[model samples]
Target: MARAGLTAKYRPQTFGEIIGQDFIKKILSRASQQDSPASAYLFSGTRGVGKTTTARIMAKAINCLNGPGLEPCNQCSSCQQITRGVFPDVMEIDGASHTGVDNVRRLREDAVYVPMSGRYKVIIIDEAHMLSTAAFNALLKTLEEPPRHCVFIMATTAPEKFPATVVSRCQHYVFKMVGLEELTAHLQQVLEKEGLEYDSEAVRLVAARGAGSVRDSMSILGQVMALGGDRLDSGSVREVLGLAGHEVYSAFFQSILDRDLVEIHKGISLVLEQGLDIGFFLQEFASCWRNLFLISQCGQAAREILDLPLEEFEFWLEMSGKMPAPRIHAGWQMVIEEQKNILRSHEPSLSLELLFFNLAYLPDLLPVEQVQIKSSESKKTSVQAGRAEKKSPAPARKLKDQPKKTSGPENRESVPAKDLDWAGFIEFCRKSPDADESLIRMLGNCTGRKQDQTLVLICGQDFIFDSIQKNGRRKIISRLAEEYFGPGLRVEFVSNGSKSNSAFRDEAMNHPVVQKIIKDFDARVLEIKKVQDRPGFPGNE
Candidate 1:
């Protein structure tokens, strides 16, 4: 009298009708055709990947009166009985309801009987993972020594819950989730069969929302069709499913690009008011950032990866030009890392608001490349100013005694001792093949000063000071310092909060590179320390 739901009405009757899992279908079909079916089969996968459906088909294929064949001939009375779930030889048990040992004992007792009219008696257990441990133990003996005329098919979403003993007695077949393209094509075919007019994007949205579950997609499509009538569009799908549309994401990205906190707040308020699914919204937001990043980096070639509609691809491509790659990359990272926190927070809406505000202000902190460029530009300006201020050429005075050479290869040129400072040392370290990039980056946070013949490096953090003081790192620093400032020049590290004058701290903070680092990292000077050279250190001695 009433039409069946799409999932039941269009359920696959044969292996060829199933949408995915080509390999498993081939193996099972061959086994059925050859009449060598396993005594027990364990089908496991996520819901709606057709585990239970496949089990029913296997029963029909085995019991078909025509012959033991690769596919069930639905024309036969045995196949029709199994299809209608009225077959006397086929028993479908719900594992959730029959979880006790007593139920399992009854099943074992009944399994001993031979088929009344078919070649074998088929017992299908759905949600087998829900069975109790005792029940599994009870079923173990029957599964291990099943009757020659009986077949046991157990389907479960979570196979991990089954005992190893029970699993070892059966042939396990793992079902894979349906791919996005396959799922979309299936939904389109279903709509065509129903004679419903639908947009391609609407069908895709339903499939994406299903997330590899055919039953879930069918259910969603049914609901959308009920409200959407015969015509299904992307707008109706988004409205019915409580999903934000492309325009919402586009406006949000524009707010981020314009650095407008007010517009961002408005966009968030609209999303909350629309009652959009927060988890799915975050997922889509992350996808948008990913698309922007790819488009920014790969340009037109990104279309191949994105696989979006021409209009949508062009929109993102234009937006990508407005945002820098580094900013897009940073935004992508922030959204991905904060998704869990936002969903877990007591006030998810508030957490989401904070996230958008953070993205809006991301430009205030310049990217690493921009910071390095500004630092280099300042250094060049300072060098040019010094050159312009020089009145005459200074005479080079010959040294009475040549500096002692350190042991190394003949081609290794000695570093000049004049004008050796922290900035110059950092530049030299960048060029040196022996210097570790991590150590060089760590040294970027330190300020240096000359205390007579010793160079004292001031660290704002205790961890940095401790890290530089390790024997291996200490030796490397000492060797580099010796090469730069000449041999026998002692180097000492002072941690934060050490005694130092305000004048020295002020000068250190004002240094070009230090100023750039402070701006880029949003760091403040905790305390500047002046180190007193010790007399008994390795180089000091």
Candidate 2:
């Protein structure tokens, strides 16, 4: 027979063999030592964190023939049978496959019988959250008042799926993911026992890839060892796992710092060509920015928090010195904010390329305070230029009918109402504090012309015409128009159909307010319908 895989072959058979979850181990061990196991237990956590493994170990601890103790002796028949999964009194059920009221009823019938070869009949259910609502209901009474000889242990990756009624009847223990340091130590022990020579960095990479799951780490180690033979290195692990190396990230960052688009494009293309996992690649890229931010802000003290290799730490320290702390912080925030978008995009390659482009130009993006200062300086210069122009003589060749110019809002009142066209009216509304933003946006999709005392607004779409025709909105528009174009001015919306439906759609879509709403809400325009005036409905006069 083929040898069992590393995860199964090296499975922890005793509480001492488990790597993490110190609190859980203590409680379960004490319970077994006193022969007072709870009638039902709920073990919940992420996969590969030893929920099922702990449940099995608890079974053996309870069934050991030597005595009810803190740990099971592997030599006894009962312990050996439980370990081999053959003990008549110790049953392991797959909750996913046995998720029905009928199956639960059968289990209830079996629970009443006395143990054939052990002190208590242990029923261990793996993935217990998969059980149907009816199945859970059927087992509720059994859990609340189980037979003296019965013990139920449920292990699930998602305990939130379990009903509160079921959870309340059991001893709930949450298993935590194994810490990086502890997981690394565990892998080192496994490698030592296998007599394999491995680089410490390689081991750490494997542990990090596992992401706090002991079994996952062991599985990754197994795959690495199979291809790497008797020795292991970081390069081999990176290649095998399709992970980008430190050099790639360093070169990428260098391109960003230099603002070299060609080099940035080449680096991203190389990553895509190598078929690296984009999610993990982005994760590592984000980590680099985080490291830069930390190093720049905290100086050498960041080394302890980073826990990076000596060479890697120095490289980041050097890179951090070249970039300002604010830029580093901005880059970090940008990466974090856009990571989900990049991952969810249909064209992740293009999204990633755009992100790199933004990073390359990060220095050019000024802070809010600096922009405000520059704006104020520009206004002062313009004011001085205006004063200089006023002191100079007017051009002799000026047209007789040329309109006079105004410099600011204070001079706006000097301009004649007849000279205020549609564009001028819109600009005035924008500067007016009383104008409603929604009304301003609706007005943008309209073409206005003055005929006698009436100002007719030719709406590009039916919706715009309908919206402005409302009594409340029309009154506000009329009031604003009268204020801008002089008193007694009237406002009316007309759907002249001068533009085609497609033209109207395009104009509506291109409007600044419409575009802003679409981008801000991630929305799309489904359809635009024209509203026909109903009989007796208020019409534009």
Q: Please give, for residues 491-524, the per-residue lDDT of candidate 1 as tens digits.
A: 8887754444576666656656557667765764
* 10 residues in a row with least lDDT, candidate 1: 391-400
lDDT of each: 0.79, 0.79
Model 2: colliding residue pairs: none
Give all TM-scores, in the order shown: 0.68, 0.69
Backbone clashes in model 1, listed as residue pairs: none
Give a tens-digit lDDT track for model 2, residues 1-541. Answer: 1123999988999999998999999999999999999999999999999998898899999889886999999889998998888999988999999999999999999999999999999999999999999999999999999998999999999999999999999999999999999999999988898888989989998998999999889888888887847688998898888899999999999999888999999999999999888887888889999998788666689988998988998999888766655457668888888889999999999999999998887644321111111355674674465445432111111111223344646335755744577766776786887665545655654667776677877764554565566437787778788887666777777875433467555655675545654565475553343312322211211
The TM-score that candidate 2 achieves is 0.69
